[model samples]
Target: MRKNEYTKNYDITIVGGGLAGKLMLAVLINCGVFDQDKLCWINTDNENFKDVRVSFINYKNFIKLKKRIQLDVYSKDYSVIEKIELHNTNEKYPLKLKDLNNHGIIIRNDILKQNIKFSEKKIDIYRSKVISTKCDEFNRYLFLKDGTKIKSALVISADGSLSPLRELCKIKYLNNNLNHTIITGYLECKNFNNSTAKQIFLKDNFIGLLPLNDEKNLINFVWSIDNKILDTNKINFHEKIIQMLNKFFLKNNLIFDSPKSKDDKFKRVQTYPINVKFVNIPFKERIILIGDAAHTIHPLAGQGFNLSIEDCFDMVKCLKNAKIIGKDFGTLSLLKTYNNIRKTRKNFITLATTLIFYVFSKKNNQLNNIINYGIEKIEKTSLKEIFKFLAKGY
Candidate 1:
C-alpha cells in the first residue's frame, strides 16, 4: 500500500465500509445501476464486529434489501420477533404491539456484514485511511493515508457520527449531548422463548431485551442510564444488571426464568454518551452523507440502522434516475431529491424517538396519561400503521 505507486479514478467513491456503505455497495453492484469497476469503497476497519452487536430490522425493510441483493429472508442467523412488550416502571400492565403480516428480525451485526457479497474483482476496495480530500467543480480527490490518490465524480460519507468528511464539508448541524450512557451486551437465560421483544422503561434508565437467533435462550440487552450513575459505579455493573433483570422479570410476572450468573456469556460491556445529531441537508458539493454521518437517534427506538438503509435505498433511486436521464450523479439537483425525500421523515423520527425517551425517562403523570389515552385511542389502527411505517418506510 504505497502512496505514490498508483492513482485511480472512479465514478463514485464511498467512504466508511461499515454496514451502511457495504449495503450500498452491494445494492449498487447487484442493481447494475453503476459500473462495478468504477465504484470504490474505503474502510478503516475491515468489517469487524464493532460496538454494535445486534439490530432489530423490521420485516419489510429486510425484504426490500433482500430482494435487491437476493438474500434469503429465512436465514437461520436471524431471529423473528413476533411481538414487542413495553412496560413502564410504575405500570402494572405492559403494552403489547404486534403485526400479523410482518415481524421484526433480530440479527447479529457482524453476520449481516459477512453476508454482503462484494467481489474484489468487481469493486475496488481500499483498506486505508483517508488522509485528505480535495474537490473541484468537476471531480473530488480523495488522498488516502497510504498516499494513493483517488478521483471520483461523487464522494459519499457513510462514516460514523464523528465523520471527518461531514466536518470538512463545512455543513452546519445541531449536535446534542444527551448526557446518557448506554451499556450493551448479551445474556444467556433459561425458559425464554425467542418470540417476543421486551422493553422496560425504568425511572432513570431504559432497558431493551431482544432475543438472538431462533433458540431464544440468549437476550441482547441495551441499558441506557444517566451518566452520573455510570460514573459513580464502574465495578460490578453486569452483576447488578443481572440482579435487576431477575427482579424485574419476577416482579412483572414474566414467563422467562432469571438469567444465570455462571452460565452467562459476556462478550463485552460498552458505554457511550447518547447524542441526537442531524444535518439539515445530508449532501454538499459532490459529497453525500448516509448512516450515522447523516443522522443519529436514540437506540431505544431501534431505527438508527433502519433509517440509514432507507436513506441509502432512496439515494440509489436518485442515482438510477440520474443515470437514466444522462445527468451527473453528483449534481446538486439530483442529490437534492434524496435529501428532500429523507429529511422530513428523518426529522419526524428523530423528534418522535427523542420525545419518547424524554417521556419515559421521568415519571410525568400528565404526559403518561396522555400517552396512555392516545395509545388506547389509536391502539388498533396506529400500531399496525406504525409497524408498517417502521418496517417499510412507506
Candidate 2:
C-alpha cells in the first residue's frame, strides 16, 4: 500500500461497516437504486461488541425493514416478545402495556452481526481507515490509511459515535454524559416463559428483562447502574442484584421466583458506559452521518437501534426519490431534505429519554405520581388506545 496508489472506486462510499452501514448497503444493493459499480464500502468490518448481547426492535420496524430491504437472514436470529410489562419501584404491581396489534422481537446481537455481512454484494470494499477527507463541488476525496484515496459523489459516515469522518467534516456535536453504565448478560431461569418483556425503574438503576426463548428459559438482562453505586462496589454485583430483585418483588406483593439450580444462573456478563451524543445537522456538504455518528440516545427506551434503522430506511427513501426524479442524490439540497426529515424525531426521542431518565433517577414522588396517572388515564380515558396508536406509527 504505497501512498502513490491514489486511484480508488467511488460513486457513493459508505464509511463504517457496522450494522447501519451494512444495512444501508444491503438495501442499496438489493433495491438497485444505484448501479453496483457506483457503490463502495469503506471499513468493511468493525469490532464485535459483546456487551450488546441482545437487542429489541419493535415489531413494526422489524417487518418494515425486512420487507423493504429484503434483509439478510433477519427472521432467523430473533425471538418474539408477545407482551411488555412495566414496573417502577414505587408501584405494587407491573402494568401491562398493550401490544400495537403485534409483538416485538429480541435479536441475538452476535447472530445478526455474524450473519448480515453483505458478503454477496459485488461492490468495492476498503478495509482501510479514513484518514482525511477533502470536499469539492462534485466529489469528496477520502484518504485512507492504506494509501487508497476514493473520490465519492456522496459519502456516508456510519463509522459510529466517535466517528473519524465526522470529526474531519468539522461537524459540531453535543455530548451528554448519562452518568450511568449498563451491565448486560443472560440469566437462565426455569419458571419464566419467554412471552413477555419487562422493565423496572429502580432508585439507583433501571432494569430491562427480555426473555430470550419460550422453551429454553433464558432472560437477557440490561442493568443500568448509577456511576456512584457501580464505582463503590466492584465485587459480586450480580449476586447482590438477584437478592435485591427478589426483595423488591416481595415487598411489592408481586409473585417472584429465584433461580434455584446451577443451570439457572447468570452468565455472559459485561458492562459498558453510557452517554448521549447529537449533531444538530446530520449532514455537512455531501457527507452524511447515519447511526451512532449522527446521534446516540439513552438505551433505556430501546430506541438506539430503532432510530438507526429509521436513519438507514429514510436515507434509502430519500435516494430513491432522487432516483425517480433524475436528480443528483449527493447535492446539498437533497442532504438537507434528509436532515430535515430526521431532525425533529431525533430531538423528540432524545428529550423523551433524558426526561424519563431524570424522573426515574430521582425516585421521589414523581415515580408514584406517574404510575398513578398512568393507571387512572388507562382506566378513565382513551390514553391507552392513544399510546397503542402511537406505538403502531399512527
Candidate 3:
C-alpha cells in the first residue's frame, strides 16, 4: 500500500510501545488533550511488553508518575526502592542511599505498559513494524509492514536506537559504540531486604544488584572487554560469567545463591553492544523523536528510562500549553522547544555516565588508590549527596 493510503487519521501516533511511548500516551490522556479516540500506538513485538531492563526512577519522577499515571497498577509489577549502595572493588567503603534523604523507585517496562492501558484516551495498537515515515506539507505518514499507513498531526518516534522512523525522517545523529557489553538477567537471592540496590565496580567490568520484590533481584553485568569476548561460539561465555560472579561475590564476601530450580526463570544471557547517540535535532516538520530514538546513553547510572519519561512529560506540557494559548503546537518552532529542553539534560547525563565509567574502569595502582581514598572520604562526608543528585536524575 502507498504511504498515504490508510484511512485513519490520528492527532498523535507513537511509533513504539515501550516505556517512553506508553508514558507519552498516558500523559496526553491525563492532560485531557483528546478523548479516547485521538492516539495510535504502534509496535511489532507482542511479548509481555515489559523490558527486562530495570530503571531507578528518582523522587521527582516518582511523584509525577503517581500524580499523572496509575501507580497502584504499576506497583504490582515493580518495586518502590528506598535505598542504593555503591561499592568500589578496591575498598570496603560504600556509598549508601539513606544519606541523601531521597529514595528511588524501580519499575519494569511492562508495568509501565499496564499503567498506560488504564488511560481513557482513544489509542489503537498496531502490531506491525514501522517500515518508513515521511512528512509532507500538511501531515506525517508512517508506513507499516502490514501494508498499512497512519497519518497524524504529529508522529513521535520512540522506536529506540535503531529507529527506522528517525532514519526515514532524515534526523542527523551523533553515534558512538563504547565497545562494551551489558548482560542483564534476574536472580532470586535470599535476604535481600528489598530496600537497597547495590553497584560493584571491578577492574574489568561492573555488576549492579537491583532489589525487586522481597526475594527477586535484577542483575546487570557490564563488561568493557575486547569485542572478541562476546563471540558466542568462540567463548564459553556462560562459564566465564559464572567465574566472574563467583569472584565478585567472593571479594564482597556476599553469599551467592543459584536461582530457584522451580522458578527456573533464568534465560540465556542476552548481550548487546553499548551505543550512545544524540540527535542534532529531535523534531523536524511534523515528526519528533523521543527516548532512545532521540538519544541513547550509557546504562551505568540507569538514567535512560527516567530521561525518556521526563521527555514525555515535557512534550505533553509544552503541547498542552501551546494548545491552550492558541499557538501552533505542531509547528517546528514549537516542537523545537521540546528538543531544546531535553538536549542539554541528555547531554549532561551522557557525559557524566561516560566519565564515571572511565574513572572506575581504570586499574592503575595510583588511580585505584585515589578512587579508594575518594570513596572513603565520600562515605565520611556529605559527598554522597552529590552522587545521589547525579544518580537520582537531577
Best by TM-score: 1
Task: Give candidate 3's error at residue 249 in angstroms.
Answer: 4.1
User: How many residue pairs clash in model 2?
Assistant: 0
Instruction: Kindly list the per-residue Cα lDDT of model 3 for residues 1-394, writing each as its tens digit.
Output: 4544784767778888777876777777777766458678886666653455566788788777888875555354666667777777667667676734457776655555565645443468888998877777767888788878788888888998888877777789888877777776555555465667777787666777776653344443343443544553375554565566567667456544445545334444556778888777887889889988887887777888888988988898888878788765568877888878887788888788878877886568888888888888887888777677776765
Tell me model 3's lDDT, rounded to 2 decimals: 0.72
Which sequence of candidate numbers ranks them by lDDT, best first?
Answer: 1, 2, 3
Error of 3 at 168 (Å): 1.2
Could you tell me which residue pairs clash in candidate 3? Answer: 36-121, 36-122, 37-122, 50-110
Stretches off by above 4 angstroms in model 1 are 1-6, 47-52, 214-216, 252-265, 364-392
Q: How many backbone clashes does candidate 3 have?
A: 4
lDDT for 101 (candidate 3): 47
Please report the TM-score between candidate 3 and the true structure: 0.89
State how far residue 6 of model 2 sits from its true place (Å): 3.3
Candidate 2 structure quality by residue, lDDT tens digits, 129-226? 89999988878889888788888889988999888888898999998998998887766555555667778888887988887653556677788999
Q: Cα miss at 257, model 3 (Å)?
A: 2.7
Deviating ranges (above 4 Å) for candidate 2:
1-3, 44-52, 72-77, 115-121, 251-266, 365-380, 385-394
Clashes of 1: 1
Which candidate would rank higher by TM-score, 1 or 2?
1
Q: Give lDDT: candidate 3, residue 72.
A: 58
